[model samples]
Target chain A: SVAEQLTPVLRESKFKESGRITPEEFVAAGDHLIFISPTWQWMTGDEAKIKSYLPRDKQFLVTKNVPCLRRCKQMEFTGVEKIVEDVEGEDGWVTHETDDMNLNECAEEMTLDSSKMDDIEPKNEDEDDDDQEALDMEEFDVDNVDPSVAIIKPTPIATTKDSETDSVIHTRTYDLHIVYNKYYQTPHLFLIGYDENRQVLNIDQMYEDVSQDNAKKTVTYEAHPHLGPSMLAVHPCKHSDLMKKFLQIAEEGGNELSVYSYLIIFLKFVQSVIPTVNYDFSQTIKTT
Target chain B: MSEKKVFQYVQFKSLVHHDFWHKLSDIKLDIEKLNESDKTIFGTFTNLNAKNCLLELDCTSFNSNFKTAKNNFYCKGTLKNLNTIESFKNFNRNELLKKEGENLLRIIENGSACKNPSELISFIVLTYADLKKYNFHYSFAFTASIEPLIYEVSPSQNITDEFSENDIENFSSSYHLLDQQQAAFFIATKHLDIILLQNALDVNQRDMNLKDHNLDSTYFCFSDPSEFPYAAWILRNFILLLVKLCPILHGKSIKILSVRRDEKSSLLLSKLFFIQLPNKIDLDPINMKWTGWERNDQGKLLPKLANMSNSMDPIKIAEHFS
Candidate 1:
C-alpha cells in the first residue's frame, strides 16, 4: 500500500515499534483469528471487488447477527466513563459497557475481560477430555464410592430466578465485519444493524447503540468498496496510533507481541467503539 | 429516517429452442405471408424445486392441440410476429400488454378462471423476424393488471412460519391444474387440517367457512414463480383472481407459497408469505404504467439482437441471395 510505504511508523514497522500490518501479515493474522473464534468466518465479498493481493476466500471476515441487547445509555447507568481521544476527522468503532453483571460492575468487567480467552474455545476439544476423565473414574469404580468419599455434584445458583420477565429483550442485532484497508494498511471494522424482523437499521437508529460521544466524531457510514451496503465504520486513521500506545504499554510491562495476535488486539481496542455488540472478539490482547 | 421494506418478485425468462425458429420460418413462408396477426402459443414451465422460472418454447409449442397434448404444466399466451422492424419498434407495447390484462380481467369477472383455474396465468410474446437475414428481435411480457390493487406486506411471519414442509409436499403442483396436477394453494385450518384449494367446493362456501378464519388460519395460496425475497409477478394476477372469486376477501391477507429447489441437492426451498390486498378490484382495465421488460446484459432498457448469419450455409445462401 502507498500508506505503508509513505508512513514513518510503517517504514520502520517492527511489532513493538508500530501497529500497522502488511497485507501478507493481515491474511496470516486473519487465519489465527478464525481459528480461535469460529464465529468469525471468511467471505469473498463481491466477485469484482476481490483483491489480487489476498486469496479468493479470505477477502474479509464477517460474524453475523451479534446480539446487542441493551442501549449504551442504559449501560452508562453503571459503567465508568472511559473517554476515547479524538482522532483527525476519521472513521472507527465504539465500545459496550458491561450488560450482564453481578451486584458489582467494576469487578464484573475485570472477570469478564480476563475470562473470555477460556470461554470462547471450541467446546468439542474439552468434551473429549471430560469423556476420558469419566472413563478413568469408571475404571477406579468411582460410582460405588460412599457419599462421603465421592465428590459432591454441587448445582450452580441461578443469576436470576424472576429476572427475564422484568428485562425487555431488545431484538436489535449487528453484523460485524473486518475489512482490510490498503490505504490505512489496517483491518478496518464495519458494522450494519438490523431490527427484529431483519429490516436494516438506519443511521439514526443504529446510533442508539453506539456510545453517544464517539458515534458522531469517529463513526461514519461508508459503503464497503467490495461487499454489501454502507455500514457504520470506525475511522482507521487513528488505529495505528492506538496500537502503538497498546504496544508501548505491553513493552513497559516486559512483554512482546506476535503479528498473529494483531486482529485479536485490534478487536479488543475496537470494543471502545461498539461496546454493546456481543461479537466474540477477544476481550484481552494475548501475546506469545 | 426508516427505510421502506421493498418486496422483490421472482420472475421468469424465455427459453427458446432452435427448432422454434425453424417452425416460425415455415409459418412465415407459407402460412403467415406478411399477414401480421396474433396467434395462440403454449409455453411450458415446471417449478419442481427450481430457482429460475424457465418459460420454455419448442417447435411443438406452435401446435393448436398442444394445450391438451399431455404436457401438463403450461402457461397460455399469445404470439405476434411483426412484418417489419419499424412496425415492431413503433408498436405501442403498453396497449398490447394492457389488452392482455383486460382479457384476464374479463375471464376473472366472468367466473371462467375460477372454474377452469387454467386461465389464471398468461403471457404475451412479440417478435420481428428478418427472414432473409436470419436474425431475430423478440421480447416477452407476463402481464398482471394491478389497477386498483393496494397490497400490504405483513411484518409478522406467523402464517409463513406455521406453513411447514409437510404442507409444501401436499401442495405438490404443476403449472396447469387442468393437466390433473394436485394443486390447491394448500390451506392450514385452525385444527391444522390441510385442504387443497382446487378440491374445495366453491369460493362462497370457503369464504363462509373462513369468515372468521383471519383469526387462526391462513387462506388462499398459489405456486409462485419468484425465488426472490418476496412474492413473484404471477401471484399479482392470482391475487386479482382470488379477489374476483371472493369479493369479501378484500382487505384480507392471502398466503402465498414460493417453492424452489436447491440446484445441487435438489431439496425443496419453499417460502410462505401473508400479503393483504386492501382495495377491491376495479372492473375497468388497469390504467397504471408498467416496466417489467427484460433488460440487456448491462441492465439497460434496450432491445437485444441475435445475428445468425455465421451458422448459415455461406455458398448456397450467397447464391440464393444473389
Candidate 2:
C-alpha cells in the first residue's frame, strides 16, 4: 500500500483502478444524500475528534434510531439460499450450485442457531475481477445486495406473529454512522445499538440484529473513529470492490455514477449486512 | 441515630471532543500565534437529565459566537479560553478554579445569573496546542460551589410522559430564541405544557403512543453528555441559581430533564429526574469553597495530554485506514 499511499487515487476519474474514493468524493456522496434524505444527516462528532481532512459538518453521515424489530433468526430467506450453501466457498460467478448429491445446511429442518446461518451463507465474492466477472455483477445489485442473500429480502414489512400479538413489541434501535475509509478508500458503516428500553446494547445483543452472514465474518466491534467507544462496524475492506461493480455497470450503461450517489449505493449494499436496522433507505440512487 | 435529610445535587462532567484541540491548533498557528491572548470562547451545558449534565466543548466552542443544533438542549455559556503552553503550564490551578467560581458567584450576586439561567455555568480552559508534535495539553474547569445540600434522586421517567417527541422538539429548539418577559427560564415549562396536548399521539398511530394525560412534573432541560447516575458537573451552579432566585422552590423538588439523547433510542432518549431542591442559601462569594477541575483517569490533579499523531500527522491523515 506504500505506492497506494504515496499516490492515492485522489481523483474520481481513476476510481475503477484505485477502488478507493478521495475525501472530496466522500463529501460529494454525503451531500447528495443529505439534500435528498432527511434520515441521512451530516454530523461533526465532538469537535475535537473531527478528522481535519473532511469538512467540519461533513465528517460523517448518521441516520439515528433506526428500528430493528426482529432478530435474524426470525427472518425466513427464500429457497435459493439453499443453493448458495452448495456453491459457498469459491469465487464462482458462473458456477451455478449443481444438483446436490447429499444435503448439508438448509435441507435439514433442524432449529439452528442463527449464527450457524453463516455456514449456509455465501461469502462476499466481489473481489476485483476482470471484465467478464464485472458483467456477472449487473443483475445482482439493481436494488443492491445479491437478491438471493440480500439480507432478509423478506416481505417489505414483518407482520406481527400471533402468540406475541399483544405483547409489547420489543424493538431495538441502531444509530448507523458512515465514515470515510482512507485505507480501503471507501465509506465505512458502523452501528450503535440500543435495547428495547433505549439503553446502549452490548456487542452480543447487537450481533443478534446483524445478519448471520456478516455477523460471523465481516462485522466487527471497535472504537468509532470520531465518536469514542467501540461500535459494531461493517468492515469496509470489500466496499470499494463492491462499489467498482456499480461503476462498471454505469460505465457500460453510458450513465456515469456521480460521486454523490456513492452513499445511495452504499446504504443499498450495507443493508445486506444489517438488513433489519430500518433507517430510511427510502430513495433510489440518483445518478446526477 | 436520628438521621438528618442529606441532599446531593447533580455534578456536571466535561465532554471535550478532540476537535477542540484541533481547532485550538488551527487558531494558534493561523490566528493567535505567539500572542497568547485570553480569547473569549463559549461552551454549552445541557439540563436534560440530572445525571447526564455536562459542559461540552468542541471545535466550535472556540468561536466567540456559535449556534448549536436547533432542538439540541444546549444553552450558551460564555467562557475564557487561555492559550499557549507556557500559560497552561504556569497557571495556578487552585487560583484559576477559585477565580472561575467567584466569577459565577458574582453573576449570581449581581442578579445576571437570574436573568439568564444559562450563565449559571461557566468555565476557563487553559490549553497548549503543540502543533509540531501533534500533541494537545490542556486543563479544564467548570465553576460550581463546593457545598453539600439536601437532595434526593427519583427514577428516570420516559420523555413521552411530559410531551410527545414533536412537543419536546418544539420547546427545546425554540426556547432559547425567546425575547419577551420572564422568557428564558419560564419559557421551557409553558412551551412544553401547550405542546403536550397539541402533539397528542394519534391512537391509530400505534401502541407506543399510549401515554396518558400525565402532568406530573415540569423540566429544566439541557443537553447532557454523561450517562445515567452521573450527571455533568455543571448542574451544580445551575441548581445554585435556582436556589438563589426562587425561594418558593426552596426545599421543594424540581424535576429536570436531560435534554440529551443516549445512543440507544433516537427518539430523544431523554431522562427526567425529580430532585429535592436545597433549603439553605449562602450568598458570600469571597468565602465560597469552589471545586471543579477535570481529573486524570487515576483521579490525580494533573493536566491531560492527547497525542494526535494518528489524527494529525500528514501521512496518517492522508493514508491511515479507518
Candidate 3:
C-alpha cells in the first residue's frame, strides 16, 4: 500500500506518460542516475505538486564565480598544413639568416677594415635546396620516428565568432546506474560515458567539474574483474556526499521534491562535465 | 547508583611482540596498586605463556547492589600460533571476533605487520585497564598476526539478515574492500550506527514510555584501540555525524568519551555509550521496514509501511525500536 502511494514520487518521473522507466531507459535518454530509492519517500503523494518542484534554472546546481570553460569546440585545422609549411620555411631560414647578417654587420661596424675582407657568399640557391632536402630526410627518418606521436597534432586555438556560437557546448553521452551500495548503506552512482562513435569516453575531460584537490581524492582507477583488466574505469568516490547535497537542496524548498526534480538538479550539476547533452530521464521505448 | 550502569563491551587484539608481554606485566603491577588503593576493586592476572596473558578486573564490589559488572581478558602467542591457542578452539567465542581474527590473519599472512608493534600493544593494554577502572566493560587480548583488526559485537541474527550475497559481492569487487584489513575496518565502522542504537536500547532497558523524560544532557565514553588507527578515527567522526543527522539526538551534550591521556590513542575506539532522558516522541522523519522484497531483485516500486490503527501503541513503538 505504501509502495502504491510512493511510486509516483520516488521511482517514476511525473513528466512521463508511461509512469515508469527502467534504469537502461534512463541511461538511453542521456540522463545520469544520481540516486534511486525504493522506499524513503520524502514527498507528498501528489503528481502536480511534485512536478512544480522541478528546478526552473541551473543557477542553484552549478558552482558560482569559478572561471571554467563553458564550452569546448575543437578548432578545425582547415589551413594547418599551409601554416605549418610557412612556419617551417620562414621561421627557420629567414630568422636565422637575418640574425647572422645583423651580427656580421655589427662586427664590421666595430672592426670595419678587418671584417670587410670576405663578402658574404652570394646567396647560394643550390646549397639552400640541398639543405632543404637534407632537413626533409631527417624529419622523415623511419627508424627513429614514432607513428603514434605523428597522430597527435596540436590544434590552433580560436576565439568564438559570436555569443550564440560561443555558448554552443560540446558534450558526451554518459550512462548512469544508481546502485544501492549496501556495504556503505548509501546510494552510489556508476557512470560510463561514450563518444559519438560509441567508443568509451575517458574522464580526463570531466576534471573541471571537481576541485583540483577533490579530483585527486575522488577519482580512483578501478579495473572491473569480471569485465577484465582492459575494462579500466575511473570511478568518482563521493557519490553519497553528492546525493546528500542534492537532497538538502531539494528539501530547502519547504517540501520534499520528487525523484524527477532531484534528477533534473543532479543533471544540472553534472553539466559542467557533459555540457550540452539534452538529458531526458522520462524517455520510454515502444515494444515492437 | 540512581540509574543502572551499563558496561560497554569492547574487544582488543594485537600482535604478541616481545615487548607486549613485558608491557602487559608492567600494567598488571600498576593494576595491582590501583586495586590496593581501592579495596572494593580487584584485579587478577594469568600468564598463559610468554606470549599469552589474561587480565580480569572486577569492580562489582565498588558498584551498588542492583548493578552488575562483567569483563574478560584474553591474550595469545604470535598470530602464527593462533591455531595452537586453546580458547580459539571453542567455536562459540564471539563469531564476529573470530571473523575479525581471520581478517587480521589474512593481512598478516600477506606480510603487512605493524610498523611499531611495541608501542601499539602497550597503548592497548593501558587503555584496557583505564577503561575497566571507569566501569566500562572492556576486553583486551593478542593474536599472533601482526595486522590488527576491530569488530563490533553484534547480534548474529541481524548480521545474517542484513548482510546478504549482494553485500559480499560488492565488497569483493571494490579495490579498497578487497584488502582484508581495510574491509574489516570499513565493515566495522559501517555497522556502528546500528550497533550503537542497539547498545543504547540494551543499557536503557526496553521501556519506551518517555512523555516527560529529560531530553538534554547525554554522555559518551570512548576507549581508543591503538592498533586499528583508521577504524578508531572513522568511528569517532561517524558517531559525531550520526548525532548531527538524527533529529532526536541533536543539541544534547557531547563529549570525547575517554580516560587517561596515556590510555588513549589519537584514534578513539570502544563501544559508544549514551546517557540521557528517554525520547518518547517519534522524532525520526524516516521509518525503515522490510518490504519483503527479494535480496537480488529490488521491486518496481519501493514498498512502504502500512498505516497502523494505533500509531502511538507502546508495543508497536518497542517493536520498531528493536
In each prediction, how many residue pairs overlap at the backbone (N, C-alpha, C within less than 3 A)? 18, 27, 6
- Misplaced by over 4 Å in model 2 are A1-265, A268-288, B1-15, B44-56, B71-89, B106-117, B153-223, B257-272, B313-322
Per-model TM against the reference: 0.46, 0.51, 0.19
Mind listing the fnat for each candidate?
Answer: 0.00, 0.02, 0.00
Query: Per-prediction DockQ, in order?
Result: 0.01, 0.04, 0.01
List, residue by residue over B120-192, the lDDT tens digit for candidate 3. 1111111222222211111222211111111222211212233345543342235121222221121122322
Docking class of 3: incorrect
Score residue A63 of candidate 3 by CA lDDT: 11
Best by TM-score: 2
Give the candidate number with the greatest lDDT.
1
Better structure of 1 and 3 per lDDT: 1
User: How do all the candidates rank in terms of lDDT, highest first?
Assistant: 1, 2, 3
lDDT tens digits, residue span B33-125, model 1: 888889898776544433335566655567664432122256678899999877776677767876887788777666566655656677877
**Candidate achieving higher DockQ, 2 or 3:** 2
After the best TM-score superposition of candidate 1, give how far the Cα of residue B248 lies from its true spot, in angstroms. 2.5
